[model samples]
Target: MPSYAVTGSSRGLGLGFVQALAADPSNTVFALVRSISSAPKLQEFVAGHAHKNVHILQADNVDVASIKTAAKEVGRITGGTLDVLIANGALMHHERNKLMLDEFPDESVLDDDMLTFYKTNVLGTIHMINAFIPLLRAGSTKKCIIIGSAIGSHKLARRTEFTDNPGYAMSKAALNIAAVRYASKYRSEGVIFLTITPGFVRTLQGTPEEVEKFFSEAEAKIREKFPSYEGSITVEQSVRDQLALISSVTIDRSGDFVNRDGKNVEG
Candidate 1:
């Protein structure tokens, strides 16, 4: 069985990945969660499934010690080998991050947002990669996939209308750089460091603000910009499409950033 470990498996796109992976009994899935006991949907899933391959382990992205412990447990469970480690956990301070340079928020808010975004989005990814390197080295596939955003690319940023989230974009850009560095450092050992953007996955589900305002505004803009646009896909579809794209990545493609449709973001 191919062993898979996905961080932030408690909700949204991460939860979708866990569900899709666990549905296949051929895959041994590790659902790394921040609070497995408190995550009702995850708890329901674990209770409902009769499959032995889906295992949930607790780990907070911002908590290095917890991630280390979780990594050790995964290593032990998978016998020190993992086929894929999806570094999917990240923080998004949307409103503050979406502000333009001249429209920057208050100094305190900007500082705090940038700091927390980097800590969780960038450093947390590095932490996952570092903690899992040994297990990856022992694995057959040795693939380390870091989830990223198209907004992160400098080429994409040239279109100011869509690149409004300067802070979040900057953080993701740094992450892309880090992923390339890691790929360069580990390529000889057969480790593939890849970054994939999931496009827009409709992250907010039932929140009133999201339903009434956020998604509607986003959908309107998408239709206006792209004539063929169909708003945002469900998280399930995004996960499904991304999994297909990820399966095609090879060591040669390591550190290259691509979107859900398998197109490179940099271009």
Candidate 2:
């Protein structure tokens, strides 16, 4: 069986990835969740599955020491080979702010929130990629997937059609840069690195206003294109599409920021 590790596996896109992978008979999923008890749905998922390939791992993306320990444990369990790795943990402080940038300048508490965002979204991604590169090298198909956002696309930002949480936008942009550099450095190692923007989806990271504004506009676009846009999409739909892209990715196509639908975003 092939082994895959996904961070932030307790909910949303991460949870969907774990479930989709588990449905495949040839895969073993090592799900890294922040708290085992806090995720009742995920725990129930593990319980409902009859397969012995599912493993729930406790991890903290903001803590290097915790990641090191989890990596060591997973290494021993998987015998030092991970077929696929997904850097899926991230945070957006602006989602919690009711004040706009003007009133929220101080509401953000920038020093603390920015540091947290960098630690979890930026540094954590780097740590996860570095820790598993050795194992990915041993797998049949080597891939490192980073889940990014369109707001982070420099080109998109320049187009005036994009908007997002300042912290998340900047952090994901940093993540893309890191992934590009890593892909270049590991070209000879055959470890393909790819970043994907999953498009707008209902997730746990945003406020009511932010969510309403984002999805309302996105839904409008979908309605414009498809006409039957009842706004229906399972989390699995997004995960499966991105995972398919990641699984088939190569150095020739790596380092390209594509959307969930597999179109290269202009960047």
Candidate 3:
């Protein structure tokens, strides 16, 4: 059986991954979230679908101990083997969507935001990989995937002149390099590490008005960059495309930062 563990599986793209992966009875799916009770949708899906292959485990990306504990639990269940580790948990400050770096009220505020972003987006991912690598090593297809952002690409930023969300973008850029470092170190072992962007996915997290406004603004910027770019896609389609890309990726393509279509995003 193909064993897959996804972090931040409470909702959004993470939940979509769990749902899709669990649809196949041959795949063992581990859904790691910060709190079991907090994920009502995930709980409902598991209870409603009764997917025997799905396992929900508590794991906060910011908490190293929790991740390690969850990894141990997965090891116990999967016999110390994990085929894929999807590092999808991240801190996305939607409220600060259009805010520029210099637009912050003060340096202290900027520092706090940057530090928080780094803690979750960069450090947390590193800790997660460190914790679950043992199980991954024992598995058949050793693939480590990081859900990255196009905003993190220097080339994209230059082309679009997208100067907002500096902290989040910087963290993702760092995450891409971190994935490459891991891929380089583990290349001889046939472990694959990749950072793939999910593209503009309509997660619909905020209020109706807020969601509308955010998408409108985001779409405008995206179109400005790529005139032929279509609107945002549903979580389902995004996850589907991402899964196909994941299945097709080989060790030779490891360490690449690419879009959902597996096209490289120039740094």
| Global lDDT of each candidate | 0.84, 0.78, 0.92
Ranking by TM-score: 3, 1, 2
Candidate with the greatest TM-score versus the true structure: 3
- Give the lDDT ranking, best first: 3, 1, 2
Deviation from native of the Cα of residue 84 in model 1, angstroms: 0.2
Candidate 2 accuracy as TM-score: 0.86
- Residue 101 C-alpha lDDT in model 2: 33
Q: Report how far off residue 102 is in candidate 2 (Å).
A: 5.2
- Which residue ranges in model 2 land beyond 4 Å of their true spot? 93-108, 161-164, 205-214, 217-232
**Per-residue lDDT for 157 in model 2?**
68
lDDT (Cα, tens digit) per residue for candidate 1, span 1-267? 899999988888888898898898999999898777757787788779878688888888789999999989998888888899999977764656557756665778778877877888898889989999899999998999999987788875664357466777878999999999999999999899989998777777567775768777877875666667666778889998989977877898887888888788887
User: How far off is residue 201 in model 2, in Å?
Assistant: 1.8
Error of 2 at 54 (Å): 0.9
For all predicted structures, in order, the TM-scores are 0.92, 0.86, 0.97
On a 0 to 100 scale, what is the lDDT of residue 140 in model 2? Answer: 72
Q: How do the residues 1-267 of candidate 3 rate in per-residue lDDT, one tens digit apiece? A: 999999999999999999999999899999999899899999889888765888999998789999999999999999999999999988876566567998988999888888889999999999999999999999999999999998889888888887888999999999988999999999999999999999889886879899999899889878877989978989999999999999999999989999999989893
Q: What are the root-mean-square deviations of the candidates from the true structure over C-alphas?
A: 2.0, 3.5, 1.2
Show where candidate 3 strays beyond 4 Å: none
